[model samples]
Target: WLKPFWLKGTSSSQRPGNLYSRPLPPAAMKTLHQEESIKVPKGIKVTIKAKHVEVTGKHGTLKRDFRHLPIELYLANSGHEVRAKMYFAKSKQLSMLRSVCS
Candidate 1:
């Protein structure tokens, strides 16, 4: 269930004389484009596949399949960061990756 809109005003904070009351100007608006990266532990090993990613750490190996996505996954920064790069991601693809990564 969701909270009612009327309750939002009571729960949210409104500071006095706040300069941020107005929204950003059109010229100040910026596009957000980010690449997701997961850190690779010192003793971990990673294998990047076209449809899946395999990671082997001190604990064990973890594999995840991303066959349906339109993004590319790889290792970066001397294999320390597992980066997910997307050329043009649909909403489904973005949400799927976000859930899995988070």
Candidate 2:
């Protein structure tokens, strides 16, 4: 009798996976903290107080409250720039952090 095509191998250990597979090194851990800074234009005024921000320009003014946001917002670089920062973020929260920073 003729053996099947797959059965032509020497044994289970002779399979391609067994011959090529290897234990890879552990992956590096993801960062938990992220920070992004944005510059403010000379003609525009940005005000940051706690989690609240107000942006004023020649056209109009905008106010926002970020107390419910997962990330933290602040003014930096001598109040000439704004920063978005997040701390202790995991996989799920990483998306949120990136979305806000973007």
Candidate 3:
């Protein structure tokens, strides 16, 4: 009936609203951008001359393709509060690659 269809559509729209109810804190994004300006860690080197940022560390150098989205990288020795953000379509594969490259 019309009631069921209306309920379905309402539920669908509400789902995303609920998921995004709490957005990323502005302070966190600001900190990330500020951190990006600093030099890479002593053991880690980052080159952002090209479209993608190239990171070289103990493991090796890895190039992350950032043709469409912005990328942010955060490196820390410990703690969950320490992290970075980048734009890469938010894919698990990209996260894995960045972590390894860092």
Candidate 4:
């Protein structure tokens, strides 16, 4: 019987391990922190508590719930700015943070 070329001298690592049928690479990954902020105008009130943000201004009060997201939201610069932050962020998380911040 004849044998295929790839089957003759291949190791386990050379074999494809996913649905795409492509070999997986052995590499290291890093995690870091991500932060984004926006300034709050003088007349607007910004509050952060219990994974929620409440903004009060001439247009009335608006509140948003962020409990579902993995990032942290806080007030900084003496309540002059609002920031969204995430620690030990992976690539997937970084992308999400960027979208949310921008």
Candidate 5:
């Protein structure tokens, strides 16, 4: 008669050999910390202060506070563009901020 495998106190899900016993390459690790930027509209005026960002346009003015998350807002391109930069952190949150700004 044939014997069952479960009676041996081992299962098929167990790995017999090393699965992840090596370190990633330098190039691969560098990609983990990436930088991203967002541009401001041409007509709109974006002012980044210590705590929040004030956007003014032909329609009206809007203010957005950023005291909750660990993000930095600043201007680039010789005061022609506003960029939101991120470094070595959660990328998912950055995408959410980008989508909302756009």
Candidate 6:
């Protein structure tokens, strides 16, 4: 069986930098929380912010950063599936988080 395309890193550069990086800082968490306040479609919403990514839906919100992470978004409802979209700036690999939302 083939795994989802999003599960695989889009680019080699996106791989983790280090194995022991700490969790997201308080400031990043605040930004993530604020980002999650925005409305989304009926399905679970997953937003990739500048410093982190926020997942919001019926179950609630969970935030995480790319420092030490995996490329997976698990939604509570089986009917609801995750959609991964990437927005880039000048270079394809570099993207602005806010732009991806809109």
TM-score of 4: 0.68
TM-scores of all models? 0.57, 0.62, 0.31, 0.68, 0.56, 0.26
Which pairs clash inside model 3?
Answer: 70-87, 72-86
Model 4, residue 69: distance off in Å is 0.8
Clashing pairs in model 6, backbone N/Cα/C closer than 3 A: none
- lDDT of every model, 2 decimals: 0.70, 0.78, 0.49, 0.80, 0.64, 0.44
Between prediction 2 and prediction 5, the one with superior lDDT is 2
Ranking by lDDT: 4, 2, 1, 5, 3, 6
Q: Residue 90's C-alpha lDDT in candidate 3?
A: 31
Across 1-102, the per-residue lDDT of candidate 5 in tens digits comes to 444664466544442443444554654222234444667667888888875888899999999887675556677886577666556555566675565446
lDDT of 4: 0.80
Candidate scoring better on lDDT of 5 and 6: 5
Using lDDT as the yardstick, the better of models 2 and 4 is: 4
12-97 in candidate 3: lDDT tens per residue?
Answer: 43554476645756642222222222435567766554346577789988887655535554544432222444443334545543
Clashing pairs in 4: none
Cα error, candidate 6, residue 16 (Å)? 40
Which is the leading candidate under TM-score? 4
- Cα RMSD, each candidate: 13.0, 6.5, 11.7, 4.7, 6.9, 22.0
Question: Which residue runs of candidate 3 sit more than 4 Å off their true CA positions?
Answer: 1-39, 70-102
Q: Which candidate, 3 or 6, would have the higher TM-score against the true structure?
A: 3
Give the higher-lDDT candidate: 3 or 5.
5
Q: Tens digit of lDDT per residue, candidate 4, span 1-102? A: 555776667555555563446745865464667788889999999898988888999999988887888898889999999898888877877787777655
Cα misplacement distance, residue 43 of candidate 2 (Å): 1.0
Ranking by TM-score: 4, 2, 1, 5, 3, 6
RMSD of 6: 22.0
Alpha-carbon deviation at 32 in model 2, angstroms = 2.0
| Model 2, TM vs. native | 0.62
Alpha-carbon RMSD, candidate 3? 11.7
- lDDT (C-alpha) at residue 14 in model 4: 57
The C-alpha stretches of model 2 lying farther than 4 A from their native spots are 1-30
